[model samples]
Target chain A: MRKAFALIVVLVAIGSAVPVILHWWPMAPDISADGHLIDQQMASTMVEVGSAFLLAQFLLAYFVYRSADRGTHENIRSIPGGVKLAVFVAVAFVGAELLALGMQGQRAWAIQYFSTPDPNAMTIQAQAGQFAYYFRYPGLDGKLGATHPEKINEGDQNFFGLDLEKDVAARDDVVSAELAIPVNRQIRLLLHTKDVGHSFYVPELRVQQDFVPGLDLMVHFTATKVGKYEIVCTQLCGMGHHSMRAYLRVMPQAEFDDWLKQKASEQ
Target chain B: MRFKIACAATMALLVFPSGVWAGTITGKVKVDGPTPKRKVIDMSKEPACAKEYSPTDPPRMESTITGPNNALVDVVVYISAGANDEGVMPSQVVTIDQKGCRYIRHITAIHTNQKIKITNSDPAIHNVHPLAEANREWNQSQTPGAAPLDAKFAEAEFIPVKCNIHPWMHGYIAVLKTNHYSVTDGSGGFSLKDLPPGKYTVTAWHETLGTQTQQVIIGGANETKTISFTFKGKAY
Candidate 1:
């Protein structure tokens, strides 16, 4: 019975690790230039964590099998180097593993958050509200207008609350429901919120940022592939959070230019 | 014979002595001042909607829709006071259709516990967001060809409904305790029927021009009372 029990434990461990070993249900394909670093960091963490889990489970199974007898009183046996060696292994191995992961992970983080965007990067503003996201591009003037909360009226579709009559700079702003960008070009997105907290998340771009109320945030990334991806809100903003989604279309440079020109003309 | 009797009964209810069975209040809403200049909405972001309108005749903001003769449209007139059956819920469903990326009716009124069926008629997806202050606020998304979304408000409050996807699509839903309400038409005409003989207060509400109320007294069931509301407008 003890042998059967240990065999069952071993089988369960193997079964649990099968998915990770076979790479089923992995992260979405990395489409951003800097996403490879994050993928590498994830791989290393998985390796370390997976080994630790397997080792602990195997050791537990072995102990249960060895102590299966209930009738006889046997002297307790310890590992070769006793408690000190166990403590030393835990402190040294686990600590070093964690430190290594942290040190390597910081590079991936810095590349995304610490480094400044290129000077020629296209700048766009993304505003998140209760249940929708709107993207605004500075029109021919290459300047964004000021936003007024009190003047914001969804009825008139003055979503950004720009005073077009008074603010000359706001007259040419091109707002769209979709985020269209040129492939292989760096993008600097300035994020803001109208009412409450919201987040911007694009799995393919490996980008996720929160829009804190009253605080404007910015994130920069470059998409290497030309395709359409869905941008979903991760924050529990309101009743409309679940339905809040927009499309991100990464197009060629010429196509993007034409699209912008067409939008401007429509305005 | 039974069908003939039913038809006769309905006709009798419709065309009886003018005031013997129940009284009705009829009125028109007028703008007291000059109409406000509407701003042209730029729907270029949403090409589907933008294509629906011509460049020469773009869609204009509908905050204040005034018709000929200073007639005020989309004004919700209701019995604010002296309503006897305040808790009676209506059994009929009120529908608000999202067609051409715009709410078909700018203003709609429903009694408490009544169902509101929202249908999306445009090709593009739409999210109906009702920002209710007193009642529970909710947002629902309906894709093209999807089933209509149903909702109900338990409290009496005015809700501003907007489509998050199409920012310009906005409307209002007025949830009232009593079923005695009417929305003015393009000619500013409105009628509230089947009112018991009593003294009541009628209130008219406009999205941008604010609200006005008047005291009315219905003497008998056949009496037809006339009450008019005039709202002051600005040229913003």
Candidate 2:
């Protein structure tokens, strides 16, 4: 019976480790990019620490079971010293956990908020709508054409309609439906919204940003892979939000230039 | 500037530089078969969503048809021109609105990178969801009388738009890379405007009818043609 109990406890311990093992051995892409490597490492350490705690409990259970099985009439052994040590270790572990959490939180904050725009980065303006993302390039002006919040309408051929009547820079703005980027280059994205709030998320590149009206938020990332990827708006903007898809083509610099030239000729 | 505008207008009519060639593709996207009964927009799962507005009641969907030959409105029938040669806007914008918790127009044409407008006219808020695989999934809400929005497709995808708050609110935005396209009207009729004089493959797509492709040649003025698409199963 004692052996059976010990075996059962061992099986339970092993059973509990399955999820931790799978989590440590993830096959899919991490949405946090490489930032989550630390998190995964911490999680693995946490699993080991939890296994130690479980082992301690199992040891105590074994001792009790053995005493009962032997039918002894003596008093239980006192491990006050060991108990105090365990408590101390637990407190220290908690403190370490809190410290790690704080460090991770700060890193996330810096990545999300404190980073400044790169001066030589390729910039693209993105506007979120009911179910789509409208991308605008400054053409040769290096600036967006005038677009007033009220003057923009998809109807009447006034899309992103930045009241060219009012916003002069908008007069020569070139708008496109697709988004293209050059490989190995930092892409600075300026996010805006014409109607509702939407989230711009790309899973393969591990980048997500929000497009909010009245305020412009920026996000930057470099494409290491030269291929086509889906640029989806994760935010629920409206009835058509599910269909809000954009294409992100990461190509060699020369190909990207050729594409730009073709687009310019169309204008 | 006036001469330039007139020159542009004349060019538009000339059908050469404007690419407004001859031999146009015209037809109706009518429901030639049995149709489904019209039901009110479903708002059961979202209980508090009803409270955001005045009366806690869902609006009736007048877009639904209850006849044998009821045309599927808002069904985007467009030409898949192919991936944009560049990031240019090769297609025109198709406007689809949300009025009284249901999608307006019922059908429209969609081309790659074509802009889409979603407007809300009702007093209550509605959550719009685009459950697309080729595109990213998204959900957004428009408040009562919110300003119209501008949406553009980044890739070629036939993405259907719906309302999460109101499940019955459904529509489609067909994204193709082609310029030869048209949306079927209430009578199931369609039109492909302004083609450069050339031999091109014309295609018609319905949200329910799958797609049909044909080859035609354009020479000069508006050339009218008729093409009909039939669905095998009953339309719900």
* Best by the lDDT measure: 1
Off by over 4 Å in 1: A61-72, A75-85, A265-267, B1-94, B98-102, B109-159, B162-169, B174-206, B209-236
Model 2 chain A: weakest 10-residue lDDT segment is A26-35
Q: Candidate 2, A104: how far from true, in Å?
A: 6.2
lDDT of 1 at A243: 65
**Model 2: per-residue Cα lDDT over B80-109, one tens digit each:** 442122244655566787754557765545
In terms of docking quality, model 1 is acceptable
For residues A1-267, could you state the per-residue lDDT of candidate 2 as single tens digits?
766777787678767777766766653354333336445445655765676667776886677567656754666577667888978988998788667666756665575568775689888888777655667777777887766666643322244766654566765565655687888787788888877789988876666778877888988777767787778888777655665777777889999988776545433
Docking quality (DockQ) for each candidate? 0.27, 0.03
Query: How well does model 2 score by local distance difference test?
Result: 0.62
Best candidate, TM-score: 1
- What shift in Å separates residue A126 of candidate 1 from its native position after superposition? 1.8
Against the true structure, what is model 2's DockQ? Answer: 0.03
